[model samples]
Target: MTHLDHITVGDQQVPVVTTTSLVIGTGSAGYNAAVRLAGFGAPDVVMAADKIRAGASRNAGSDKQTYYKLTLSGSEPDSVRSMAETLFSGGSMDGDNALAEAALSARCFYHLIEAGVPFPANHSGEFVGYKTDHDPRQRATSVGPFTSKSMVESLESKVRRLGIPVIGNCRLVDVLVDDGNVRGALFLRTDVGAARSAATEEEIVETNVGEEPSPEPTGTLVEQLAKEPSRFLLVRATNVVMATGGPAGMYSDSVFPHGQWGGAGAALRNGARGHNLTEWQFGLASIKPRWNVSGTYMQVVPRFVSTDAEGGDEREFLSDVIDDPNLLASLVFLKGYQWPFDIRKARDGSSLVDLLVYRETVMRGRRVFLDFRSNPAGALDADQLDEQARVYLERAGVADLAGTTPIQRLRHMNEPSYQFYLGRNPGVDLEQDMLEIAVCAQHNNGGIAVDGWWHSSVVDGLFPVGEAAGAHGVYRPGGAALNSGQVGSTRAAQYIAAHRAEAPEGDGFDAVATDVFGRAATLLADAVARFEAGAEDNTGTLITDVTELMSRNAGLVRSRASVLEALEQVTQWLESYPETVVVDDSSRRSVNRLFLIHDILTSQYVYLHAMKDYLDHGGNSRGSVLYTDPDGDLPWPDQDLGLPEEFRFVLDAGALDGVTQEVDWNGAGEPVFTWRDVRPIPSDDDFFENVWRNFRTDRGVPARQS
Candidate 1:
């Protein structure tokens, strides 16, 4: 049964929604959780979303977005243990989560397939696969550029069929906790319009200067409420599944969909432990349409160009770095497969292209673009191509077209990729104009800590799946994230179905809701008061500033000094956010913007703190980020590439690989950091009878072997 009650917030009455299970995203993981929960005898399940169809799962894609799974059609030897070992080998990954992900991968993949996500299969009815980055076996598959999108659509269809209610336009402001456990969540209903009609014009008065701030007058409360033109929604759920995606707003150079700032801030504020917060995945992406420019986009070998702020001063930047035309072209080709920047490959591999792009854009403050209209250094002759590049092109049937322009080869090789740009709004005619690019933040490898059953490490009945869960460690295979989201969500649903299917017992909710919403109201009131007193609205500016700060200091490149400085700045921003942040107007949009800024700042502070702590623990460059080593050699130091000293990084040669760093934001003071050994993969009884007996006894959800 769904109960709609009311709670008093200041003088306003906020609606309270009660449900058995609440899924806090409309992404693949969230929708799947809802579908699975409903299917597994859960009494009631509802979904809450910031915006329907407005997330990375729907908007983000690459040339051929991959989904990693166990090898299905190959003659090659493979097992659950082998797959788990491969995932765990990524370093810092917990062996048990890896094992769980590996064991359930096929079940989850087939679930997607059964739900109508059309993963390709051969005539023999075997799902074909390919090798992706960090994968030794051919365990990757794709339906197209929008694998996650397809998954979301299919799972959403299932959710709809199950009659699961999805409430959109709900921005999670806080996760309501009671006595250390999750009670529910507080949200600002963005769709509510002009609900504060009781306030009169006389009540909306400006205070005389910033005199000792008195208790808000009835009018002041109404006036603050009026600005929002919205209402608060208090949702009390037995279980809250947070699949709110990554902290996209944390980086200015991000490919995450616009307006999907993520709900991690809410979880973190509620004392959710963060695991591997320092592991982020960065890659090259087009800035305009915000899509990963991996695979065929790079294999075509488009000309790399740089320009001044006004788009003038056109120069071939890569040509300036590498004189060998074939080597330069080969590296670009390699970038197709080795898309994300790996530290091991930074010095003498495809990742050097990433560094050059960073140098031209971030370091030199020039705009970088892929000029598909022209060939790099007037390229010609497929015979002159490196063997790897030539053979790949020959197999792709683009070898003979290599002498032609990049666009021509792209069209002949992958027409869909060439047409993808033309299909975008304000589309780029790759045959004519240059496509601007950046070293974009694509995903976070770490987030809220969880156990084998995808339950939050600290909060009972709180599960963080998808990118929100810090399931991955230092590195992951391409498409592993998609699989991880599926498997993790499935596990959470199974556990909830068997154990926590009933509504939470409570009397603590009233107190918790009052405390949480009261705090939120004060923060909002402070913002409005600051705005009324002539404080300039820096909401947009602050977001840009924070993103820029993160991208610069805590992005793919890091140093002890830079991280410490950035962490200090974030700390200052957090301290002053309420008092200094000004809402442009009373519109719910503006109010939400203020809250978003705080959330972004809160996330940035936590992330930078994790980075600072990691560096403090003698962490060196690994995964997507490179920690600068003053003693290290620069890329092609023998050449005159004008590479900055900061680019000189020494890779951490597996010293800290066996351990993982976790951070806890206790909602005050400095975030505490802890390092722990990764949980080893479980070797449980494989005898069918023993497993079946435990499975049956435990209601189909076995206890965590670890």
Candidate 2:
């Protein structure tokens, strides 16, 4: 890392760091990208993050967090082309990216193994695997519940060993641009005095950092800011890799670990186009220390219970809807394998469980829980379970037809599942208390657009890998995201090392940097100036309002009116944010919150706009999202499900599968939305000599077509 001449912004001296490559996250993808970039001979690489210990990669996992890869052990007939075809089969996915992910899956997976990610392997030295949702082949592997955490730690060690600089406590404020190219990036440093704390008051000169800087205020806010210093840090790089996770902060009911507010807002604010932003995956997950409650947690046939606002009136909500106890148990068991809520399965399949959860939690304002202390409907006879459920339970050696409770079955079947909750900080003993759960946002199927090499489609010198990049589409195989992150980061690092190795020419960057910093300073100053000592701190309320709005209208269930209303409200929020949103304190925490709210609102507007546009385009219920169609038929009309008219919906059934919705925010009124036909899978020539010649020339990184 090289430090360039310092620039003055609003009476503060800001340090500018320049590098060949700058990675803006510290997740598995970001760490992998940095390690690979340095390994591939990139001159210099650096990583910047808001918090080093935060992010989903290190803090989030499931019953058995999986890593999807090509079939390596089984005799199943699997090939690169076959895996690519399966990935492309997911609606609205780009074919080239699918092919790239498939072709490089093994390389990335092995890279993880070499980095010390202990993926299970059989005695024959073949990596064993199991099938996951939407997977045709047995191509999923895991190292227990902490699979991603293991991957992050392993890759992070590689990054540290490579001597990469990881600047922490810096939140990305914006992606600075020059004309149409990515010049660099701007970050808000919460720890400002870490570099030069000994500067005397006599040496420092006062200058107008904001639009007009005046005498320092004597208010408590000024003293508070003095104690908690904040400054802006500029990173000038030739290549910027956005490996930040998905836009998980946009929804209140989300499984994304806290502090995983992604960089999509920064990319989108700077002209990066979003692809298929409307597609997201939602599933049942625990509340505190948020974690996915998939696999055996559901397979145990835990009793689904709900209570009123005060947790008084306890009732088995699922039993209220479904009279057949066996069918209910069967549905809950199926949720273990078919975890994500699927519109196709909403009729009579497992996803009906998700709907009931949603109805109880969101519609009726009740608290839902998975009660493991007892069985539902008195006693559950495993022999009476549906054939699929009975066989799975018996195969797992937990087919207790007697009086065993869910907790006992869980302990006998998967001890790791029981221990996970038992070992948490505010732990829950399944034998004693119920596990609070809700239908929560798990992942975004689409995000910032990227091409085959994981390079940004909208900006030069910009690459978006991992969840930040929209590699998946309407539906993806479970655990495919982990593979996509590794593969995409590797592709990005390779491309950068080969083509964009040199630092960006620092000719006109200072001017651009100054302008960008000036805008941020003005916003911060204005917010500070508007701070009131005893003013009602609506900051928390505002965040809750927006997040709840998303969860209610734009979550699994949606309607045209609710979406439009939410969109309009968000627009109003965005318009009045500067004037309306006030800070309780001017500390680093408050300042970070100030900027993050802006990012969240910007993301919400763009996402909600994409959803509204899709509805306007006549897009129906598809993927995890269920659009209300009053004219449509009820999913289970034959049964007295008591589902409201709002639940009446029709599935798209591949009608809109061939197209992708793209949105771009110009930092103006509303983001521009458009639809484009999905690119077909390529049929490349496999002639050995021809491919070898091309590989020899370009190192197999194909040139982008003009």
Candidate 3:
């Protein structure tokens, strides 16, 4: 069944190229993995969609992107152990893997800085740090709004310098899984950005002519697209790295770029199990010109405004909902730390802003917004703020502007925050117009399950890193995503380099390529027939329906009834996929969309089913994993499943003391879950020893350490 010639995919003939290590995705994690493998002298081919800069890592903007690292200075008494404890305290699964990530965090962060990422260091050459979502220690630093961009640009430069190959405009379509092992992967090279919807995209800000654009990453597929249209290309490798970033576009209300469908569904279909798929982090974000409004968006005390559809009836909505003025101001300030929505926080009024915003947008069916030009009308008197909120402003050096306009405080606190809106959003003048907002899907704390070696649990030689590697529990620190990319990439690379000698050469390129080619061709041929037949495709509407399903049923707050209902609808959609057509262009964009939509359908099934099971088994209401009703704050029907009655499951820094969830598999081999233990931190054991042992086999020290 092996063939050396090119495979026919629609009108395009795609050639098969084989390599040793194939890295899927060219974002922060993928590029870092590619570069590290290259540094270890391992050949790697990185695959990307549209371009390397197309991921949230490169495109997503935050006020000052928090890059969480362990405190390098001895000023804070933090260690790998403390960081590990914090990671595990976020809740869900094992902490052993998280412990390893914590250990390598400092090294990887410093590595980025050395590689030319200009992390903002003060005049004294000291990289000062600030607080982020989940950290007591001041371990976060930033270089304005472009933290991931900086990391990626530096890594991209290093990648170019080392001549690592990165293939762009490719979407991972068919994974070469044979004999229970992943040997290679296949991608359809085409522009399927319109797969989800034809909603008009906003204009990206233009850089000055003299400013150099980000460097292009170079990679070889065996990617075989010659621009004739859609071509099926196969890349055979000794190992495949999954770094496709978060599952965006999965929700109707998401901050993720509209076209950001990724590898979660691809991995799941191929029997690659994921971790914490039911657990996610959702919060407020901008819509039209998609962006996450975090950090200073709330810190500067923007006025929470709402209005009718015609822009006539203006109302300061938060004032009507909340009675206590100081509590209102304090809740806004809490958003600086508790950015992601948690049902537990909502009950205590901490996450009320998110709930109120949700209520306004979805329930009341009114537009909600954050206007920086003014404070909440008649509510935000400087003397009216809680002493804590007032003092926080003073500490941030914006006390003088506390009594002034919100934009005035924003300018004093974060000048970049004021300037970020100069031209990006249409009609959005922070100095004038109110910024429309919603509780959008921010990040999935869930993704492909992997071992300590960063290898996929389901397949040998498959390494899942970055957001693809769901090591995070229910919640994580703000900038930990960037840190996780570096740490996981480094681990995956080190493991590959150190163990490549002993890895079983799973399958030859010819056999794997031939098999994958047939699979891709058949799928493509059938999909093309659908497009040609005009098979009842409601792709755009279907995508919108599914996203709306996630937003309404399975967003930050969820209940068993809503989730189960959503599952019913999703299952119906999956069953009648004939109703969904692959939107196409001459480039076989339709064919490509077929694969993407299928992946999404399966991913939805996995999330709903897993969540249902967890709720059935008495999964506690906590963090971003909401189960019980938020309205009555009703307790989940504990089906006699023993869990700590008092476990708050707070997803914050130095959060809840202890918890764990043991993982299992269904008879079909899909991942299953159950509660494990409430581990108390032992004071007697040496902190360093616990984490040190995590790096070793307990049999011996790793060669890198030696």
Candidate 2 similarity to native, TM-score: 0.94
Candidate 2 vs 3: which has more lDDT: 2
| Total backbone clashes of candidate 3, pairs 3 or more residues apart or in separate chains | 8
Q: Candidate 2 residues 1-706, lDDT tens each?
A: 4444467766877777777888998899999999999888888787888877678888788999999989999688899999998898888999989998899999999999999999998889999999999999999999999899889889988777666777777889999877768888999876662233343321122211232322222332223333444477888888899988998779999888777878788889889999999999999999865789999998989989899988889999898888888888988999999999999999768898999899999999999989998888855677888898999889988888455778998999899889888776447888899989999999998999998899988788889999999989899998999999999999999999888887789787888898888878877766766775445556668878999999998999999998999999999999988777776444556666677888898899899899989988989998998899998877776777878788899889988888999987878867888889888778998999999999999998766665
Task: Judge candidate 2 against the unseen true structure and give its global Cα lDDT, from 0 to 1.
Answer: 0.84
Clashing pairs in 1: 227-586
- Give the poorly placed runs of model 2, Cα more than 4 Å off: 193-230, 532-534
Q: Where is model 3 poorest over a 10-residue stretch in terms of lDDT?
A: 639-648
- Candidate 1 runs further than 4 Å off: 193-230, 637-641, 703-706
Q: What is the TM-score of each candidate against the true structure?
A: 0.93, 0.94, 0.86
2 against 3, candidate with superior TM-score: 2
Report residue 705 deviation for candidate 3 (angstroms): 19
Per-residue alpha-carbon lDDT of candidate 3 for residues 678-702, written as tens digits (9 for 90 to 100): 4333343457787677657532224
